[model samples]
Target chain A: MDWIAADWGTTHLRLWEIDADGGVSKRLDSDQGMGVLDPSDYEPTLLGLLRNRLPEGRATRILACGMVGARQGWIEAPYSAVPIAPLAATRAVKAPTRDPRLDVHVLPGLSQAEPADVMRGEEMRIAGVFASEPGFDGVICLPGLHTIWVQVSAGEVVSFRTCMTGELLGMLSERSVLRLSVGSTGWDANAFAEGLDRGLSRPEALSSSLFTLRAESLLRDLGPEASRARLTGLLIGTELASVRPYWLGQDVRVVGEPDMAEAYSRALESQGVAPKILDSEEMTLAGFRAAHEALAAHAH
Target chain B: MDWIAADWGTTHLRLWEIDADGGVSKRLDSDQGMGVLDPSDYEPTLLGLLRNRLPEGRATRILACGMVGARQGWIEAPYSAVPIAPLAATRAVKAPTRDPRLDVHVLPGLSQAEPADVMRGEEMRIAGVFASEPGFDGVICLPGLHTIWVQVSAGEVVSFRTCMTGELLGMLSERSVLRLSVGSTGWDANAFAEGLDRGLSRPEALSSSLFTLRAESLLRDLGPEASRARLTGLLIGTELASVRPYWLGQDVRVVGEPDMAEAYSRALESQGVAPKILDSEEMTLAGFRAAHEALAAHAH
Candidate 1:
């Protein structure tokens, strides 16, 4: 194996082994994300997972990204200020290791000063997008727990905004009063469309609109499927409304899980904006490869 | 004791003994609210709390309001349609009891048909407001887990909207990613005012604005007190913007706990609306008294 590339996020850890030809030879993942580990646990956990895989005679260079570099994670890889390239391999921080065959470098995340925002693992995905389409310029939407919208220019992330839409939807559907109305598994396309329209037209009424779902459930017997779909629609629509300046009259690309990317695609199409959907895992791995190549060039 | 007045809500049960002169002679409370009891558990729980309080060998009439009358509560009192008086004592349902010494009457809640809204406990408080001011014609704001804004005309509930503002604040502060930024206790008036302005002026940007709090905490070292206060301001301000028609150019009365009412009052005042703050407990008890009086009138 030539090297190892890892994306250690808050709730997940994914690793890819690259051969001398720069092709993935093996892939592995674990739930031992940064959220569940102490500062001292990262090296041991990595070593344990890579048992019997590391070459015996030499130290294997492991490139890592994401919350694993957070202040409370394995080690702080201080955020690289933006209006800069997403691949900050030259600025990567080496985490202390006791194992003879382990050499780990955690990549820095991106931060914006004004309207303060920070992203960890997502920068690599942005880098991957730039790798694939070197001249791509416009908004890139990365939807997940903390959805982000980035404006790209000259292969650098010029500006961006983060929306807590995904987290809010999770909390509202599973923990809030709306939980009684919205079931975990259900799909109602028509209800979702209606909710998107309501949210886009009257974003100011978002809070009250949430309560109306519960009221409808009690008074009109609105089914759980419709309720859940509508709730998702409302949150996403509100997010789209807030970020209209980012996607309006611009080339937009959405990189996320298939289902989430599809949802964003539908919402955007309804607003007359055609957004390209990209595979999240593909972008993430490509991003790691780009970072690896940058590190190799610096080494040479 | 002439009779009993009970406010049995989701989380609490508060009872008052009314003398022949229609004044409260004794008061008691319990945490055995409707939420914790089953159909059969209600009778026993009520009996246990009222032990040695009920008159011997004689039936005592218990007039109760709130969630205790919900479909899943002790017994379903059902909901009375709106454009009607808040006090629906004439239509109160009698809960069957095995003990001859118990005669419990559960009051119905209010429901709006068009916008699809329902209120279990707030109706009684609205009735109390009307009881105190017989010819009151204005808007009544009841702030709590489910903050309510009601339009009143000619002693009847004209129309109303329920904002899930308080619940959202709780969920966001205690359960969402914002929990890391906001603390349980502390006050920051200036930060709150700023957030209120931001929320009111640009309600569409709420989802992104919420994430900004977390970023500010990380980047600018924004304290927990300021973050919490700002979160509250944003939510309440958004609610105020949505319910503008209900309070603008109308006599506004806020009925709630001191701290919450004060927050609402300050937000409203900033928009040039002078709202009168009323004691929530006083209104609730008065509403109970009003229901009891109507019951007596019917008996006569």
Candidate 2:
């Protein structure tokens, strides 16, 4: 194996062994995310995941990203200041390891000083987008627990904003009083569209609008499917309103999980913009491979 | 005791005995709110709380308001349409009972058709405000898990809005990633004031601003108290911005728990409006008493 590309997030640890031909030879997945480990446990955790993969004497290079580089991670890779290209080799930090046959480099996340925003793993994903599509320039959105909107130009992340839409929806539907009314399995495209418009028009009423979902469920018998869609729609709608400056009349691409990226595409299409959906897993691997190539070129 | 005045909500049940002169003779409190009980458990729960207090032979009148009147409560007391007086005694419904010793009346909550809003216990508290201050005409804000803002005139609830500020703060602070950074106790008045202003000025950026709290905590080691206060201030600030029309150039009264009502008072004062704080417990009793008296007068 030429190298290993890993994405260690809050809840999942994903790994891929890259061959000399730049192809993924073997893939592995685990529930051991950085969130569930103590700093001392990271080395053992990685070794357990790569039990038979590492070479006997020679060191195996591992390029990792995500929350594993957080301050509380195995080793903190301080954030790279914004308005810079996504993957700069010098910004990567070497993580100390007891196993002599293991060599790991954790990439630094990006940070914006003015709005005080930060992103760890998504930086690599955005880098992958730029690596493949050098001519692509506009807005890039990665929707998840913290949906991120970025302005990219000339192979650089100009500015970005993070919205707590996904987290808010999750908490509201699972923990809030609305939990009793909203169900897990259902979708109402019509309700979602209406809620989106309402949220965009009256963004200030976002909090009140959330409560209305529960009230409607009780008073009007709004089903779980419609309620779920409406709740998601309202949050995403309000988020789009905030980042309108980034996406309006501009080329927009969504790089996220299939379901979330598709949802963003639909929301964007409703607003007269057809957002292209990029495969997030492919982008992540591309970024990791690009970083490995840059490191090899530098050594030569 | 002449009758009982009770406020049975989702999380709490508060009761007060009304003497002949309309004075509160005794007060009782319990955690047995309508939420934890089924239809079959309501009568037993009430009996358990009023064991020796119930009169031996004749039925003792219990005038109750709040979620107890909700569809999922002891018995459904249908909502009274809005744009009507605070106390519509004719709309009250008597609970079917096996014990003749209990004469229970659950008052209907208020409902707005246009925006599809509803309030149960708050209607009684607003009614109490009208009963005491006949000239009170501007706005009444009751802050809680679900804060409510009402425009009242001529003893009628003209129009109202509900904000989930309290619930949002609770979930974000206790459930989101910020929970790890924020302390359970700490305060930064300046940070709170600044956050409130930021939230009010840019309500559309509410979600982004929330993420900034976590960033600030990580980047600057923002203390827990400050994080808690900032989280709360932001939500309340956005809510105030949404309901600016209700409090602008109008008399405002805040009827809620001391801490929350005081917080609202501070926010209002910052906006150059001095809001009067009324004891929510007292107001609830007064409204319940008023409803009971109206029922008695009709019988006479």
Candidate 3:
């Protein structure tokens, strides 16, 4: 029988149908996000989208990940603890749906110890990354709104830390007072590196440093984009100050979107460390498949 | 001759009319603020309000301070250095309006040497604060959205540092994902202190700590107010880290609104230092008034 796997996040959603051997044959997209969506709407929306993707008379079992397990998602499959492997959450539930042969299961998310953070879809990808290479002991950094630094040892997540770097940058650029002082787009690698340096040097002064963009623009006539760069430098530099303690003198691996992967690696490079990149998409997909296998065993 | 001095901020507008002796013969208030008014409407609205307030057929000189002098306001005046003195931004203009005799002057702001930040109306206030305490030595702390810590020596506004303490708290309390985690009202002193301590201790971890509030509320039931306190603690504590180093082992003076003064003093106390509170309103007004007197020398 064919099966389906989904990765639903805050801003978007993606679904894929996998054959019995785990090869993806069909895929789907929708705006029905779990971010603002009501828990009750999860099944109907997923099934609605799922029905459209399948051929006539096709029987399918489905596994879903991402925010579909968050507080606002379907059934609220709460997050679990460290060494939190794929299928770590308690046995998956065969979500009751209107279509008799359509089996839907939501995967439980993963959490880490020390610094203390959690992840959902990525855990699957980490498992997938590890599936390709067993006994991988190192740090896997997932960069995004919530940048997670997951420590894996002996094939399990040991500990992690979360940084709202992207979210902070977004809020400052789009929603906060800094919004008044920044431009839409520009890149200055030198300015970015300068900011990274400052963040590492005097991190405590971060919040106050944010207002400097406005002051410098008004006082020194620093152009808007330059002021924007200064702001980014200030925040990134400050983050480096705190996180550098854990990451410095260590080998790091990044598993995320390409651009983000580059930025994350560059951030590590500023501290004189090198970081490798892994496939974030595959990380989540492999995690969902791991859960799928676990579910199959329970059914048998 | 009659004159007017106005200190208009984001939420409110305050104007003081002075006689030759600098005595307040009249005062006016309105909801017209740069935060609320359209940039294009400032001239018409300001003139309309002032014209109505003037004695019939009488002319009065007007001076403006605060955000009204920002880019969106009457005119963009640049920032000056600290000890910018009362008369610094003295190229006061006769704002073009239907009434030709009405002269409006916009005060240029001041920037500090340490911590690299700037201020507008508060500059005049810092002057006044220094003038009032002629021979004071130590740090004078101004608490607000951007908290300024000014160091004074020999009756001069030496240098200062700005902390985005208040703004960060407002963001966490109102706009962040933690908003729901923290209830609307109720300020927990314990939580506030915790935040101050944490902020002071590991300020770099702040962006991540903010998200932890949400993670925690989901993990365990953080009572509405406690969660609020945690968010508050996170912000203030972060600021304490920034400001404490300067005040530690040194006497610090607290300025501004009383509650704000109290918060600063408390943050200082956590660092084993006691702070003295001063009248921030009186400081700013006196600063402006001093600036007015210094400017009056050239007016005649």
Which candidate number maximizes TM-score?
1
Query: What are the per-residue Cα lDDT tens digits for candidate 1 across B148-235?
Result: 9999999999999999999899999998889989999989999999899989998988899999998999999999999999999999
Q: Write the per-residue lDDT of candidate 3 for residues B178-254, one digit (tens) a residue.
A: 67688987677777776666777788788778767676666666667877776766776776676655687776777
lDDT of 3 at A246: 53
lDDT of 3 by residue, A195-265 (tens): 77777776876876777666666556666677666666677667667666457777677888876677667
Q: Interface RMSD value for candidate 2, one decimal?
A: 0.9
For every model shown, what is its TM-score relative to the native structure?
Answer: 0.97, 0.96, 0.90
Q: Write the per-residue lDDT of candidate 1 for residues A120-208, one digit (tens) a residue.
A: 99998898799888889998999999899999989899999999999999999998878888999969999999899989999999999
Runs of candidate 1 exceeding 4 Å displacement = none
Q: DockQ values for all predictions? A: 0.84, 0.72, 0.54
Total clashing pairs for each candidate: 0, 3, 16
Which CAPRI quality tier does the interface of model 3 achieve? medium
TM-score of chain B of each: 0.97, 0.97, 0.85
In model 3, how many backbone clashes occur? 16
